[model samples]
Target: MNISLAQKARQNRIAALEYLRRTKQGAEAEGEVLNFFAHRAREKAKPVFFSVRARMDDERIAA
Candidate 1:
């Protein structure tokens, strides 16, 4: 399925917010600043990760 530019941007923003949550700053989740931070990371060459932890957790889940 094809997504619009705004929708894709929103997805990026959410991915960023999740990254911040899993990283050393999980306590501070503000809706406003997530997109800016995410874009900054993107500019530095980081892909948008939707659920990295979830993917890794499959090991335990399978067991």
Candidate 2:
């Protein structure tokens, strides 16, 4: 299925929020993020992964 750019962005934002929530609660988001990265890495590799992380970090800092 093809996802629109807006849909993908929404999904990424949801995932990032969940990650931030987990980390703030002293929960382990490392494995979840790593698993997500590993799966995406097979398709688009490192750059996408880093970009996602960067966006997430940026959002975190802004909040």
Candidate 3:
């Protein structure tokens, strides 16, 4: 692999870890960080299926 390509890959990894660290620090809402990663994963062509629901939502009972 070319040096330039390797450097770019390293930078990407470091940036990703930094973003995760910020999430751990609570710099942004937890949902925001999670959604950001989900969007990026899709852009990178990852196959991910997930279900999300708000914790405050009231449950419905079938009659």
Candidate 4:
């Protein structure tokens, strides 16, 4: 399933906040968390690159 950019950004921010809380960084880590999420969002905004390959059945072709 594909999620919208805004949804993904929101999720990233939530995760960053959770990490900050878990690490007990408190308010001091606020900037770091925001930067991390901003970078994550930018990374996600990049286009996805992939490749597809076709598999051939040798036995069927021989028959």
Indicate which candidate wins on lDDT: 2
How do the residues 1-63 of candidate 4 rate in per-residue lDDT, one tens digit apiece?
Answer: 999999999999999989977776654566444467767887786786544422235445666
Show pairs that collide, candidate 3: none
Poorly placed runs, candidate 4 (over 4 Å) = 25-63
Please identify which of the two predictions, 1 or 2, would achieve the higher TM-score against the true structure: 2
Clashing pairs in 1: none
What stretches of model 2 exceed 4 Å from their correct place?
Answer: 27-63
Q: Write the per-residue lDDT of candidate 1 for residues 1-63, one digit (tens) a residue.
A: 999999999999999988867763543543334467776776786567768888779877998
Clashes within 3 Å, all models in order:
0, 0, 0, 0
Where in model 1 is the C-alpha error above 4 Å? 25-63
TM-score of each: 0.37, 0.42, 0.37, 0.38
Whole-model Cα lDDT of every candidate shown, in order: 0.74, 0.75, 0.68, 0.70
> Comparing candidate 3 with candidate 4, which one achieves the higher lDDT?
4
The RMSD (Cα, Å) of candidate 3 is 14.0
**For residues 13-38, could you state the per-residue lDDT of candidate 3 as single tens digits?**
99999988887778455545456776
RMSD of each: 20.3, 22.7, 14.0, 17.3
